[model samples]
Target: MSHAGDGAEVVLRLDRISKSFGALKANDAVSLTLRRGEVVALLGENGAGKTTLMNILFGHYLADDGGVEVFGQPLPPGNPRAALAAGVGMVHQHFTLAGNLTVLENIRLGTEGLWSRGAADARAKVERLSRDFGLAVHPDAKVGRLTVGERQRVEILKALYRDARILILDEPTAVLTPQESEALFATLRKATALGLSMIFISHKLHEVMAIADRCVVLRHGRVVGEVDTHATDKGALAALMVGGELSLPRAEVRVPGAVLMRLDGVSTPNRGAGPGLKAVTLELKAGQITGLAGVSGNGQAALAEIVGGLALPVSGSIMLKGEVVTGWSPGAALAKGVARIPEDRHHQGSIADFDLTENAVLEGYRSRFSRRGWMNWRAARAFAEGIIKDYDVRCPGPETRIRLLSGGNMQKLILGRVLSAGPEVILANQPVRGLDVGAIAYVQSQLIAARDRGAAVLLISEDLDEIMGLSDVIHVMSQGRLSPAFARGTMTAAELGLWMAGQKFEAPDAA
Candidate 1:
């Protein structure tokens, strides 16, 4: 019961699927098919309903209309257990493992067993899979202590433990280092060799081109085009996904002005299992975007927290506009004109249950949205309305619960709120993490605009293309210590990659 496709054998199919939440049409008659032993890249912009479609397929949500079939058999709507039993598994953007538990324990969970230390069997299976797929994860290590890449491997292993023949990955490369992403791709290739099918979702076209055997693109909640990866290039896919040539204009470098923010001898405790940052000294200049590029969990999170005033540095002096704010709280930092778009939008940026108006006023409610320590509903609503319009956030006015919006829209809201504050220094960590093509471009443009407006921008991201595209100067961090600053024209991807792996290479001084 395979989908009637040209060459490859179809193992899963979505037929005339449609889903809507009130006025918003999340998926509209979308149809796609996954082939056995083939990697299908699901491409789309942030709000194109790629994730939603995947969710529906995985039984996270029931489609309002239409039906799904696996191997030519009808599927029950909104039944995850049925989907899993039918050999479907998913690795989500946010990990779902219990952090404190051992990898074996995490993988063995949900199994019907009482006496079987299943831990032993799971560990053996994990080791075998790791060797076969090139995923490097310590099976005995506590999930809490693993790096982001390692944690991702655990997620994949968890799915494999369920014997998922068709695995769905949502933005798998967003949190990975270059080396880690390449390794994962190698694993995918290996998995394909073993007759496993995959549905890989990503915004990066290069990845799709490199790994996928076929590509299915979505736009405005519909299947716009499907192409053979071998026959198409990134430009063609980008055009399909974005509806235009992707324009990434380099930001003109303004000579960095006075030191707007400075961190001297900052030695923070290691937040992850990796080494702590040494006495790192760096300066953020006014009217410049300083890119902190590294694989995730290499102290980038800690650095952002320390700079944003969320975490006090164990040993350092943080001077913002010449005033020492070494131990200032987030509120104090905001008052002093430091705006930050946190990495984890769900955890730090916005409260899911809160309405747009409330979330918009989260950071600077005291001054912009309120006065005399009293809530000003009228002022806040007006301000929220302006941000929604200006930032192009699609929502049901300011009263909509932020959780209801898509990941891309939620990010837009955070960026809008941060930009509206008119802060002097902005700390953005993975600012465009889950956004779509257009949204990524928009966010990059907004960062450049902020820089042009004389705001010192600290851009922390694992995305090398983004760093190379938008940064005036690149600073690569490895094991919590930053390399010598690389002027925009001096560093190459290979050079940055080497530095990120702790290779001692001097950056050419002249740009």
Candidate 2:
């Protein structure tokens, strides 16, 4: 029953697949094939049915019509076990890890259930696997202590532990630092060389080009095109994903004025044993975007924490507007013209249960929306309405719960709150984490406008497209050290990716 068209070629195939929800056609006669040892890029925007299709394959949802074939064998509808038994494994965009548990416990949680017979064996194997794949995770480390990149490695290990031959990675690099991402790609390449097949889902076109052998573009819930990565460029792939021209314009050049924020000899305790920044020094100038571009785990979080007033630097001076503000409280940072949009919006940016109006004024509720040491409903409602209209935030009304909005809308609301106060400095980390093409454009436009209006921007994002689009100076971090390469104007994505993967480059001054 192997899907070897002429010997050992095709491994999986979907024929004329279609799925629907009420009147909406989620998948329109889509067809694709995964050849042996191939890495296929599934490209699409949000709500474009990429997840829907994957869900169908993973048995979360059933296709109304058509068939799924693995090794040329037909798969019954809505059977996850069958898929797993057939050698399919999936790593979701969101981690399904229990935060309180250790890495080994989380990995063995569901698979072993109430029994714990192979704990030692699994740990040893995971360690070996980590070393083999360059994943480099501590199996004994608590999941909560693990950075985003480490957690992702655990997820990948979990999939592999199940003996899966075909892996599905959903936006795998979305949270990875450039070095971690490169390490991951190296693992995937090794896996492929060992006869494993993979389907990689991502919004980043350059990642698709770099890691994938073939690319499949999805738009409006349909397969638009599939082509070899070697034959196409980002421009063409983006055109297919957006169904039109998707040109990301560069921010206008501006003369950066006074030092907005300065960090000298910044160092923090190793959040974990793996890597923590060492003697970090950086500066953000008023009216410019200083992009911190690193592979995921190399102290971006620690840096954000220190600058945003979440964590104090062990030994460093943080200057804001020419005044040293090291060890300042969040309130003090805000008072000194520093506003932060935390990396994880759900946990740090907004209160999910809070209404739109309430979330809109979360950071500034004391003075602007509250009065007489009491809640001011009128001002809050009016302010929320203004943000909705001005920022084009799509929501029911001011009373709508923030969690009810889409990821893009929530990001818009969070950004609206920060920018509304007109802070002189903004620390935006992964600002557009889960946005669509249109939403990304809107948010980028907002940041660009903010820069033009003289607000210094600290743009930290895993998406290189975003960093490249908005950064006045791109600072790359690798293994907890800042690279001296600062790219400007038109630079190739490959070069940036290389720098992000820890390649040594000449100093920015030399460039």
| Best candidate according to TM-score | 1
lDDT at position 436, candidate 2: 68
Question: Candidate 1 on 1-511: residue-level lDDT in tens?
Answer: 1122367677899999999988889899998888888788898887788878988987989999999999889989999888999999999888898988888788887864524775566678889988877777787899988877788998998888888989998889887777778778878888888778888888888888888878899888988999888789988898898888886557886788878889989988875476667778888988999998987767787788788887877887888778787448888888878889999899789999999999998887877666787889998899899999999998778999999888878999999999998989999999888777778888889999999988999999888999988888999888888887888979887778778766653446412
- Where does model 1 exceed 4 Å of error? 1-5, 98-103, 112-114, 117-128, 136-145, 270-276, 322-327, 368-380, 502-511
Q: All candidates' TM-scores?
A: 0.87, 0.78
In model 1, what is the error at residue 311, expressed in angstroms? 3.0
For residue 420, model 1's alpha carbon misses the true position, in angstroms, by: 3.2
Question: What is the per-residue lDDT of model 2 for residues 1-511, given as tens digits with 9 covering 90 to 100?
Answer: 1112234577789888899988778899989899888888988877777888998998889898888999888987799998988889999888899888888888787778625685778888778777766677888899987767788988988888777888999988887756667777888887887788889998777778888888898887899899888899998988887788777657987788888888888888886554666788898888899998866677788888888887787787888767777458888888777898889889899898999998988888886766789998898899999999998888779999998777888898888889988999999998888776667877888889989999899999878778877899888776667765374665566777766666554445423
Candidate 1 C-alpha RMSD relative to the actual structure: 3.9
Superposition TM-score, candidate 1 onto the true structure: 0.87
Model 1 score (lDDT) = 0.84
Could you give the C-alpha RMSD of every candidate to the true structure, in order shown? 3.9, 5.3
